[model samples]
Target: MHDATEATTTPKSDDELKELVSLARLVAYARENARDLNAEFSAYCLDLAFGALIQDLDRSGVSLSHESGQDSSLFGTRH
Candidate 1:
């Protein structure tokens, strides 16, 4: 999990790119498979927005940590 306050202004690493790709794939899958038009459109818009953010982050070289701490309680257990 990323702690926004702990983020640094550094270039995104290969690991970070991989993580973002994974997230994008999940979002894309939802957008492509959703039956409801509203849900599909919402996911499509979200994907577009997220893509823009990624581009901006790449240009700005922002480093966002993808570490998962002992804070699974926020959204229940991962599994």
Candidate 2:
């Protein structure tokens, strides 16, 4: 989860990028697959925005998914 207190200027870590992409995909899937056009459009916009985030992370060499490892649970760790 993002918080107002967290420094927004710092680059996201690999873990953060992975989690962010996962969440973006989840939201896009749920919203885009809905019966309403409004929902689909909202999902499209969200997907577009998240795509930029993905590209930025990609440029930094962060992968969207792990091939062979346990995925970290955000709730399991605390800053």
Candidate 3:
């Protein structure tokens, strides 16, 4: 959930890296909590995360269709 337009003067500093590490730890904690939930709920969360990632890519003008060549359809007409 990072804003694309927000400009940063410098690259990730030591504190920023530390914050990223902390966020990773939190994600790990969430995974552990998910394991305690039902299988359906865990799968739902995984799917939701994937959908969010796809939406973000779309927002950034990343086309996932076969026409873009990055994702090729099995029966798509080739140029």
Candidate 4:
């Protein structure tokens, strides 16, 4: 049986809230696009990996503020 004496709480931080929203969106996208579980899982995993990397950079004082100013192409210049 489940415990009735415990109380539940919602996500308190922006990161936590974003994670929940990302999960919901991922599942919804998978269902709507008929994507395979493997593909969806891979995408979610990659997203988490990149997000953590960026967070770590920020914590280490390596700002990604210039990210938007950099070239978005495959290389320094567009093809």
TM-score of each model, paired residue for residue: 0.43, 0.41, 0.40, 0.35
The digit string of per-residue lDDT tens for model 4 on 35-61 reads 344567666665565455444435444
- Cα lDDT, all candidates: 0.50, 0.52, 0.44, 0.42
Report the C-alpha lDDT of model 2 over 1-79, residue by residue, as the tens digit.
7563453456778687777667755644554454245676676776666565555555556554322221223112222
Candidate 2 whole-model C-alpha lDDT, 0 to 1: 0.52
Query: How would the candidate models be sorted by TM-score, starting from the highest?
Result: 1, 2, 3, 4
In the predicted model 3, the residue pairs found to clash are: none
For candidate 1, list the clashing residue pairs, or say none: 1-67, 10-61
Model 3 per-residue lDDT tens digits across residues 20-49: 444433443454456556566775675465
Alpha-carbon shift of residue 27 in model 4 (angstroms): 21
| Residue range with the least summed lDDT across 10 consecutive positions in model 4 | 70-79
The candidate, 1 or 4, that scores higher on TM-score is 1
Pairs in steric clash, model 2? none
Candidate whose lDDT is highest: 2
Model 4 C-alpha RMSD vs. true structure (Å) is 12.6
lDDT of 4: 0.42
**Could you tell me the TM-score of candidate 3?**
0.40
